[model samples]
Target: MPLMRIQLDSDRQTARRVVELHRTGKVHRESRDAARAEVWRRGRTPAGETVFVGTTNGEPVRLIYDVEVYRDVTA
Candidate 1:
């Protein structure tokens, strides 16, 4: 198993949300943060935090993902 690192901008709230999303099969953390950031940008909350989902190391169908929860925009 490879070690996956999820990069976040020190936002615990976003991190938690990502964790929940991953748990419920809402998204995957396979794609790199660079690629996933685009998707996350689309799902920005009112707090301006972008939630990215990506898969880590697992299997083709069942892969574990790390959420790169961060704030892409600021008010």
Candidate 2:
């Protein structure tokens, strides 16, 4: 089975929320500071993350996205 990958920014609690949403109900490591992140298809719709990286002065502003993907390869 081919796994999916989702990437989010490391600012504005964006990554935190993405990880929480994709995260499975079943706990694995139970660590708030997990070095590695996990990816999951929530509700089968999204395809990929849409990040808009730029700067105005000295801060980096990014827009992240979580795609909902629905596809039954077995069927």
Best by TM-score: 1
Model 2 global lDDT (CA atoms, 0 to 1): 0.35
Tens-digit lDDT track of model 2 for 1-75: 323334333554543444464454432232211212333323343334422222122234333333334464564
lDDT of 1 by residue, 1-75 (tens): 222233434244444555677678664343334434543565732323224444333223222234333455568
TM-score, candidate 2, is: 0.22
* TM-score of candidate 1 on Cα atoms, chains taken together: 0.30
Best by lDDT: 1
For every model shown, the clashing-pair count is 6, 7
lDDT of 2 at 62: 34
Angstrom error at residue 63, model 2: 10
Q: Model 1, stretches more than 4 Å misplaced?
A: 1-6, 28-75
* TM-score for each candidate, following the candidate numbering: 0.30, 0.22
